[model samples]
Target chain A: MSALGSIVPLAFGALRRNRMRSSLTSLGVIIGVGALIVTVSSGEGSKAVLQAQLATLGTNLLIILPGSSTSGGARGGPGSGKPLTHADLLDLVAGVSAARYSAPVDRTTTQVVIDNQNWLTTVYGSTPEFFAIRDWTLARGRFFTSGEADSGAKVCLLGQTVATQLFGNGDPLGQVVRVKIMPCEVVGVLGGKGQSSQGQDQDDLVVMPWVTFKSRMMSQDRVHVGSILISALSPDEVSHAQSQAMGVLRQAHRLSDKELDDFTVRNLADLAATQEQAADTQTGMLRNVAAVSLLVGGIGIMNIMLVSVTERTREIGIRLAIGASENRVLLQFLVEAIVLSAAGGLVGIALGLGGSLALSAINHWPFIVSPGWVLMAFGLSMGIGVVFGFYPARKAARMNPIDALRFE
Target chain B: MSGEPLIDLKAVTRTYLTGAATVHALINVTLTIAPGELVAIMGPSGSGKSTLLNVLGCLDQPTSGSYRFEGREVATLTRAERAALRLSAFGFVFQGFQLIARTDALDNVELPLVYADVPGPERRTRAMDALARVGLVGREHHTPAQLSGGQQQRVAIARALVNRPRLILADEPTGALDTRTSIEVLGLLQSLNHGGITVVVVTHEPDIALYASRRLVVRDGRVISDDRQRAHDAAADLQALPQKAA
Candidate 1:
């Protein structure tokens, strides 16, 4: 037989003789590799979910909220300062050349009743441009037009949750639902958006004209809009649009150079980028932990191999005395160590993939199988075998045949 | 019996440091062996007969000596070259049989050929042939643990013969066997030696030395006697033993 061909079977036979030791020695490798796979796949899966959630926030969109208001020395959060006004929104749309569409938004939570069914949901006041900027599509009927909005029409769009709660399977397109005291006709049902990245249900709201909302449902003045939503002409112009809108809003608010503007222009892209950076940092920490476990697994293999060499000293003597060269004995033991570790790697990969599959299924995330990482993990395990198995194999090879044969 | 001596050792010595004292294992041993001869080396415990066999088989290097195999100086060989020489020209049979525990008789016999880089099919064929030569045909697949003491020794002898070495070095070949089994093993060695292979056996038992045509008695790290005589026929001795209950 070829030298390596023969040596390999000899190695296998020796390992088979001590099956329990072989398996236990490889357990560390299995757990390390499995952990690596789980961490990486989950990291990728969560990243994908985040990207999808960010996409739902609309492309190249920006939100303009009133700056925080300090009341009794306690600073209230954003959207509590001098409220955005209709005049400021008009000035921003006219002055910001990068802006594609702009709409005013006011939101409040109230109960709506229809027939014998009553459900509580947030109601939003917005112009027709709001639907375009949100990229929202109607699953049924149609959205209210700008003319209807200007005439202060009592037409409204129902979010998926509101539609389902109020109408069940029945058609609600022409049904009139009582919003607080005003009965408003449901013009459309918004498409289901599942959940936001923060796990909040996005499909649970009602939309109507800003004039109708301020005049009827809300106890607020008609002059102030709560917030303004804007979309840039393209993705590349989002930053330019943000800066332009900020400059225009500062001028419209009549703020001096030394004073802070009474508004905040936030880019959705920037928020998504920050969230992505946080996820990446978490994934990097997890990867380092997995790497350390793999290193520990390698040390475990080395320990067992050293013990195996000592236990098989007599076997080494027999081989050497039987005309086997030092290299031959070394190759035999080296092959044994490699086979043990590589076998562990294979089982670990299977375990990691299975664990990833179960976790993704449970969490409703995509099962992303990165072939590159799997191959890298396998190669690294084999490298661990070679690196850790060398010392013991060399020790076996360097033994004097006489002393070795006589080793008790 | 030969053009040049098959083995020639001049003033060979081997020493070791136990802890504080230097001990000589072999002291200025001079010896020669010819082809087609069966030589027995007799000694008490720690008398260095095994050391002599090791030096003859090229398993160890002499401390300060001129030792030659055929015509090549032994000290001139590199470690790998010496290993290659052992693989090609020498076969060792130890008293313990030294058959790998879990391996079958056939694989045990094929080990020397494996180290010699012989290809698979031929190695198996040669191993089977060697097993048959040692009268171990039906027990080819039996592991060392499954075989009797005589059968294990026969398997070791088959391993020694598989490489078709010109010289066979057996250290206390019958040390671990009963008289009947030892006789059977000795009969196998006798037949191989008669096939023109030179054989050297180290033994503490004087009865075992009677089977060789030449005997050298070692004492206190030196050879005390060397004599040539008519060898007892081990095949006849095996035939004379009474049949035991199966």
Candidate 2:
């Protein structure tokens, strides 16, 4: 057989010579790569799931809130100091070039009594357009018209939790719920929403006409005003929409050049943009961590090869003293190191792909399976073999025949 | 001597640099061995006879002077060039047998061709031929660890002859064998010599040396004696040596 053929048998021979050591070395690589596979795939899948949820916050949606009154109480960064408000929303609707829709939301917390049961819920009051903007669909009955909202109509909608708590499985679309000394007829029941960021069952909240909420229920003069929710005709117009909304709010708040406005605009696009940036950062870190694991695998390869060199010193001497060239000996050992790491890489790739698949299947999450990354990882493994395995191979090649023959 | 000058060493020197000092292993040795010759190198433990054989086998380079193999100056050859020179020109049977412990007899014999890049079928055929020549045709699959010491040395000799090299350098080939095996090993070397392959066997025993047509004695890194006999037959020499000694 050719000298190269000997490499195949010799590599196996070395492994057979010390099966335990070889197994232990490979075990390290397997563990490192396995953990890396799970972590990377998990991180990628989680990011995808979060992005998908964020996308449900439609591009045409905007929220108007009681601009947090921190004008003199501003304690954070410049733009973050402002809160979104209703006047800002009105002005933005009248002024923003990109804003195609806007909504002003007002709400209160009240204890409602029905029969012997008492339930506390948020009462959101807004124009009927709020449904289209917030992407909320009514499960029964109907939302009040804009004129009814302006005229302070006595109509209400029950959130999912309040409906279940009060009505059980019965229909309550036309029933009346007493909202703390005010009786408003239920006009609609909102589809069940799991929960909100503030730990309120979004299903449990009630809704009413904004004018009625302001004129009949709320006694505050300015009414919680600052938060503005806006939606552009398309997702891409968010930047222009943001600037236009800012200009109108600035004009209404009458901000001077030295003064940063006391209001902000938050839209679906903004939330999506920040989330995408975060995803990018997380994905990059995951890749870096995986790279480190592969590097550790590389070190394991080099370390085992060196041990093989020491163990096979006499064999190397015998070959050299016979007729083998130094290069041939070196090549034999080099090929051995590369084959080991490459094999390990192949196994790691399969495991990594399978791990990604399992995660996607069980969690219903999205993952990017880039063949480029797999190929890069495999190539890196081989590179590790060549770069790290060189020193040991050379030492084996350079050994003195007489000394090696006498080695115990 | 057949007047062939198969290997010629002129003013050769080999030096070893240990951690603290330069050690001269061989000093200014000049010698020539003719074709079909059986020569033995004899020396005490520290006499450098092994080092001399190493250089002659082309496993080592001399620090000074010239070594010519088949009239090609060895000192002038590159590492690969010397590998080529060693492949077709010299065979080594190390003192330890150095039979690549895990490899079988046939595989051990095929090592040279492996370097020569010979194809698989040819390598197997040639290796088997060498094993049969060494009377181990049926035992080609036995590893060195499985075989007796004499058999291991015989495998080593088969390895040496597999490439059909011109000169065989055996360094204490029978050192570990029993007396009977040693005699058998020496007889094998004699038979190989009779087949016209030059052989150089290194040992410390006079009996092993007596098997050769010529004996060179070395002391303290220098050759002290060169003795040649008209005919070499261990059976005849054992009988004749007593009279010569008296």
Candidate 3:
């Protein structure tokens, strides 16, 4: 009686007549749509998980790496370039508007020995403020104080992994481990930090007062330390703080106007943003490719429907002679095509959702599915049926009744 | 005999091209049939009998000539308009019985009304009545495959009558049936003609043609003779005349 009701029976009849062919056609759309769904969902999920990890590093932190005359080399330039000095740090603390907290760290890779056991680890020479800058915490005792650091106290804190390795479930507190010639007492144990995506152990390190490590242990006048971790008040002030810190350091270094800046900046927030953009681009690209398969599936339906038209030529003529209008005849075949594609789309959506959901467990990652993709796949299939099915439908509708009656 | 001609054709010509060759299926044909007339169009193979039925039933457009159906000139009718004419003014009983396969008798009969946008209840009621009139009320749910050839033809006839068309066009309606079943179908068609419905049957068999009161003999594409004969039980008596005469 209505358009919806009329098409239902017609579509149903078509599907009933060709069960296996219809299922096969739908399988094509299912695989294409499912692949795109899994790709975009997993991509988005990975991006979210990665960003959450980056957030734990503190969005406010800015990194400053150690190098001599511009990022070219660690080799000293001109008159033997000095390591990041306290004068440069103190000037920035006094002059910069956005430096809420900053620390100049002295870092190296060295082996610490206890009896016959020796652990190769990254050693940090830092003030107490370094913990606050990197958003780290102590698992056991206390960090070295500012006074202790300034006074060059020969005490150190073992990272969780190093302590566990050397202490063997026994207390590392009040115990002493050898670092080069000096034996440093373990005053604290830092919390466990697991491996990064790059597979490096975060807890395989030790921290000491900057003064004790810099002057007494290494004894070299020039420092080739690693990164100086700084934290700004807010993420909005990071760019400003960075520039102000850079300007203060450049004036302190007295570089020529033609010289390009030496150090590399690793802003976790910016890194997260760039990765998000790349994921979005990849999602779009994958979705487009998936849509092409939907298009191909539609074309397949048209091709099959065209064959069906020839096979059913006499049937169409019978309908026409029995008083079916051209529009009615067209609608019959069109309904058949649409029913096929829509069925395919529905099956594909289920398969895709199941795949992604199951993949979340199999791969141990988050899975996400968007409703928009499902709707799009369905609409695309229907559109393909209508657009591609028009020609054959027209041919069927225009068949001569006399010739059709005689068709064998 | 008393009423106006329900169909009038003036020099209708229908042509079709097969690759490079042209087929003059029907040419220079003028014919007229009034209400309540029982007419038979008799012609051999390749004589354009089916083509003539297509034109007469408004299922085709003549390449040249005028055709009036129920007082309307249908020479240039659009496909939709011809479909409407088929729905409202003419019903067809095809040679193959042409019942939609896998569909029940009632569904087959109700199909044309579906396109006419007839409401479901009224269509069902009228289709049932038509099937009952053709002695197929018990077989309304039977598909063509499940029914005998005679029963299938009766369902097709019921489908033809469901629209209450002014003209009933039977194109070899009994070709697929036995001699006994053909008589039963021809008897029903004659009864419908007796009820003031215009009936036209196209048959090459003289025995079949003898059942109709009026006959048009076709030679080539043109009508060679139009004559009236007394009603007869031609299928029973025709054994004396040789099948070649038919």
Candidate 4:
């Protein structure tokens, strides 16, 4: 027979003779590889979920929030300052060339009651342009007209959660609901938007005209708007739109270059970039952890191979005495170790795929099956076998034939 | 020696150092065996008969000596070269049979040819032929564990002869067998010797030494007595036993 072909059988025979021990040694590799696949796949899946969540935040959209407020020598948080103004919104929309649409927003947390069914939700104050800027679509009825928004009409749209909680499959259109003691006609029901990246429910709010919100509900002043939502001309122009809007607001607020503006410009693109970077960092750490576990598994293979070499000292001697070269004996043991780890790698891949499937199912994330990761993990296991098995194989090959033959 | 010696050792000395003490395993021993000779080396536990066999078979190197095999100075050969020489020219049989366990008899016999890099078909055919010569033709598929001690030794002998080496070095080939099994194993070796292969056996038993054409008694790491005799043919002895199974 060919030299390798013959040696392979001898290695397999030795392993078969110690079946339980060989399997136990391979078990470490299986767990390592399985965990690696699960970690990477789940990481990829979560990243996809994050992207999906970001997409819902609206494409190429920028949000302007009051930067920070200082009261009594104490600086408040970013959104707690100056509360963006209506004139600031008008100047930004007119001055920023890349700005496609802009809308002022104000919100209040209150209970809405209809036919004794009351639900707590955020009542948002915005214009018809708010729906366009936020990319919000109606599942039923229609959004308020610009005239209704300008004329301080008592018309509102219910988010999916509010609609479900107040209407319960009943038609919400034309129904008047008491939103904090002010009865308003439900003009539309917002489509379900699922959850945001921050794990907040995005569809638990009510929308109404900013004029009506100021007149009937809460109004701090005629000049102050809680926030402003602006859409860019396209996703590619988002950064340009952000800088243009920032410069326009700075000029309108009459803040000098040396002074910090009392407003913050937040873009969906920026949030997505930061979230993606964070996910990549987490995925990298997880990959390192998996690699370490695989390393430990390789050490296990090395340990067992050393033990096998010691246990089969006499067999090695016999082979050596029978004219097998030192390299032949070394190759035999090395092949045995590789076979063990490769087999374990295969099993681990199957287990890892199963784990990813479980994770995707439980988390409701996309099932991401990356073939590259599987091949890499399998290749790594094989490499582990070679790297860890070498020392023991060399020891076996370098054994003195006479001493080995004489060994009990 | 009547003809050119197949193995010639000149002033062969093998020494071992253990914890600051020197033990001369084989001390300045010169020995030669010509073609087609059956020689037995007899020695007590530490007389170094096995060491001499190891040096003769090219399994080991002499500490300070010249070992010539087939007129080639083998003492200067590298480890790989000595292994190649052993593969092409000599076969070894140990007391433990040393047939890889869990392997069939045919595969055990094919081990040497594997190192020789023979093609699969020819290795199997030659291994079968060697097994047939050892009279274990029908037991080719039986593992060493399934075979009796005599059968296992026969498999080992088949393995030794599969390469068709010019010399056979057997160290206590029958040491682990019963009297009848030992006789059968010796009979197989004697028949191979009769087929014109040079055979060297190392053993302490006088009864086992009776099958050799020449006997060398080793004492204190040196050959004290060398005697030539008409060898008792083990095959003939086996035939004389009425209950002979092989």
Candidate 5:
């Protein structure tokens, strides 16, 4: 231990004698480590942002859209087939054991007016179960009741955008708003949900009872819904719920074994997984590039250490003649290399953190600092020092004291 | 003189393979150095004087023969063991005054003790004392470039003395200094010898060899003559030289 203690100062003194060369040699490590930190932390930040956006859609959510229509060998795209009905939603909830909540939805776009202020927005007609499936809660007042939905009462709930557009900062609940020519009373105001994964504003719509919407707003068939939204009991049950819903719908439609599904069920969990995988691939590529740069940096260290060994041959001879052992000489050079690379690693970490903070602020992403990655980067730099330093140290240690002292 | 000889070499031979040519650096040379004796090995270039000094210092092993230092067989020791023996028992001074560049005198003197694993405070005290013994008390902080050639040689001598080794081996210790400075350095070595440290000096100049009590002349890798003579007083010689004009 005392030998190591003495070796450290000797190493430092040698490095200090050639400050410029030492700094330049470690520059490669600095850039490599800095780039690694920036790429990894920013990758994590983007991934977090994407996950939060996905979460805003709902928990264990699934969307079932109507399949394509076929006529005279001509096929229309999805949502052009025989529309799904409220009965199909009811059958799915009853048949699928994993199904937690389900809602039948019909949508239309129209202008809404409160007094003299008018704003164009999308309107959704759904039951009270829609709020549960979407994981939505009211900011004020209460959601419309099932009685109002079944009785086809002209009551509505306002999304934050719609409320802001028509009422400004005024109380929106209990106020009356006109959808086209029909007036409806606002029962509640939904809490804000920001932009979604597809960059669409989720808070730019109004929701009302399905009975009132089919009768008064949209001109579609009264019994058929545009789509069905379902939530599974847990994240792991989403695929099971989807398969169960498909079976239930196929049986309800009386389709034969040879027939294709009349509706398409999409598991949002799968979509999330695919997006997360893409993020991981991007992060992995950047990490590999950073690793290559670090390798180049290690090579640079080795090159400088070799040159330093040659330059200090006479010094080695003097030390050896004064009773320094071969291991002592080897330790001295190895310590110098380690100190150089480790110091570079520290500076790189600081630079990378600063770069990540700046990028997050500029791009409006959450700042995520992964301590494990930082430690690994530091360990990698130190390992490079040891691996690259050994050959030169060994060369110096094996020198003949007579020849070395005579080295011109 | 009653104890075993400090160094014993019996028919030692060292050869070099220089690109398929066998060069005999030392050929069947047998010699012994008693404790506290000042000996000089004199020869022209390529006569194996340096090689003999290297063998005695344990920096090189004989190609074939027994080399015993303080009654211990040096030929059987490993490279690391030889290094440890040198560290504990030998000090070396070179022709170029091989002090590490850019380091102060005190640090150069402290070099050997650093490998000895001496603690910091004690190493400093001993280094300072060694420097003061060489009459370099106020020049402890001067680097090799900052000090004169004579001062640099003194720093090298101080480094050799700092380890308190039993033997000091100097190969042309005054090769780079002037006449008066050479006498000063020889005076220091003679005083060290008087203080019971064995000294072996390798030089081609007969004047330099006159400072030692005994001399061995070498020719063609063989010792031709060995003689015991009264050594000149380096202090008296330094006093007799005329002072330089300021």
Candidate 6:
């Protein structure tokens, strides 16, 4: 170990004497490692942002839509049955063991008009429990009470985008907006949620009480629900919630064990997981690209080291003649290569992390610092140093000292 | 003054095969070098003076022959063992001075000890002592390029002496210097020999051969003449020359 330790300074001195050449030789490794770090950080950031948006939808949340119907061998897909009734929503809320918050939903696209300006937007109808299930918070006023919902009051909540479009700088609270010829008072404005994972604006819908929607806006008055939003008490209870909800729905539709139910329950967790898997594939592809770049960088190091060995033949000869062993000569050149690449690796990491932080700040994504990735990249760079430095080092070690001494 | 032989060679021959032609660089020749002798081997270019120096320095092995240092045969040692022997027992100098460029003289002198795994403090002390012995007391920090030709040669001699080896092999030590610098370098070597280290120098210059106590002339792979003489005093010669401004 002491013998190996002594070669370090000699190696560093040799490299330090050729500063520009050493740095240029390491440039390929720098860019390779830097690109690797950026790819990993950005990939991690994107995943974090996706998970956060999923959190807003509430962990283990589920949505139920009316199931398909088969009429004379013509089978329609889901959302084709008789629209779900208010009684079904109430039964599911009361019967499902793991279900925490359940609310009936109804929605339509219509023009929301203020005094002179009008905009086409989605309007939704649900009980107050919809806010709890969807984890939505109000920005200005309160959500309508249960009494207001049961009495079919004309009060409505304005999403941030709709409020901004209709009221602009004016206070949207207590202002009546016309929706399909009916004037509804805006009781509150929803908080901004930015964009969804699909890049759609989340704050673009207006919401009203279910009873008001059934009585005035909906074309049919059979107390039918377009869909139902439900969330489990906890993430672990999602599967249990799904099975219980399915049983209650099947029984309510008067279906036997062999008969298909008239409702479909979709687990949002599974959807999020599938999207995460897709992101993982993308991350894997980026990593492969990084590995290829590292390989190219390693080749660059090998090429330069070979040239250096050729250039320093006389030096090698001198050291050998002065009692340096074959291994000592090998270690000197190998360590020089390692120091070059390690310096490049560290500089690349610093630059990559800074670039990642700036990007996250500009794009409003979460900044993730993964020490494990940094270590792996550094280890890989060192490994490249060893692997690439070996052939040239061996060539120098194998040289005959007498011939090397005589080399011009 | 002769004691037990420090180096013994028996019919050592070195042959080189290049493109199906065998060049006999050295023929079978027996020689013994005793301790405390400054010997010069003189031959023209391609007359194999270098080949003889390399064999003596353990930098090359004779194609066929027996070489013994003290009493141990050299042909039986492994490459690593031979290297270790060279590290601990032999020091070498070359026509080029062979000091690593861009490295300070102190570090250049410390090279052998570094390979020998000597501790840093002791290595530094011994290297400094060796530099002082070569009359380069305050030039430890000077690189080869920063030093004059004679100074650079002194640094190389310091590196050779830093290990305190039994033998020093120098091939054309004064080849790159002018007459004055060459005398200065030869004076340093003479001083080292007076201190009881065995010094073997290979050169073609009769001026350098005159400084040694013994000379072996090589021609056509054969030692044609061996003569002993009273060694010239290089220091007295340096003193006789006119002094330059310091």
What is residue A341's positional error in candidate 5, in angstroms? 1.1
Q: List the residue pairs that clash in candidate 4.
A: none
Q: On TM-score, who's better, 1 or 2?
A: 1
All models: lDDT? 0.90, 0.77, 0.80, 0.89, 0.91, 0.88
Question: Candidate 6 on A118-146: residue-level lDDT in tens?
Answer: 98999898899898888889899999999
Q: DockQ values for all predictions?
A: 0.67, 0.59, 0.67, 0.74, 0.83, 0.74
Instruction: Mark the regions of model 5 whose C-alpha exceeds 4 Å error after superposition.
Output: A69-76, A114-117
Error of 6 at A209 (Å): 1.8
- How would you encode candidate 3's per-residue C-alpha lDDT over A1-408 as one tens digit per residue? 364566568778867888888787667667776776777777767776666566656558777664445346566642244456667677777767787887778778888889888888888888888888876788998888899988988899998899988888989998899976679999999887666545677788888888888876677543444456678879898888888878877776685778755554456667777867877888788878887887787778778888888888788888888888877888888888777777777777778788888877786677766788667766876777788777877778778876776688
Model 2 regions more than 4 Å off: A1-5, A60-88, A111-119, A137-204, A215-226, A267-297, A347-368, B1-4, B19-22, B230-246
| Candidate 3: segments with Cα more than 4 A from true spot | A68-82, A112-118, A137-145, A152-160, A163-193, A215-217, A220-225, A277-285, B233-246
What DockQ does predicted model 1 obtain? 0.67
Model 5 global lDDT (CA atoms, 0 to 1): 0.91
**Candidate 1 lDDT tens digits, A1-408:** 368788888878888999999999899888889899999999999999999988887778999998888889998888778888899988988999998999999999999999999999999999999888988889999999999888889999999999999999999999999998999999999988788989888899999998889888777578888899999999999999999999998888888999987888889999999999999999889989988988898899999999988987888888888778888888888888888888889999999999999999999899997999999989988888899899999999988888888888
- TM-score per candidate: 0.95, 0.87, 0.89, 0.95, 0.95, 0.93
Q: Comparing to the true complex, what docking class would candidate 1 get?
A: medium
Name the regions of candidate 6 deviating beyond 4 angstroms. A68-82, A250-263, B238-246
Q: Output the lDDT of residue A265, model 2.
A: 55
lDDT-better candidate, 1 vs 4: 1
Name the candidate that leads on DockQ.
5
Chain A fold similarity by TM-score, each prediction: 0.95, 0.82, 0.85, 0.95, 0.94, 0.94
Clashing pairs in 3: A30-A348, A71-A262
The CAPRI quality class of candidate 5 comes to high
Better candidate number, 2 or 6, judged by DockQ: 6
Identify the superior model by lDDT, candidate 3 or candidate 6: 6
User: What's the residue-level lDDT of A98 in candidate 3?
Assistant: 89
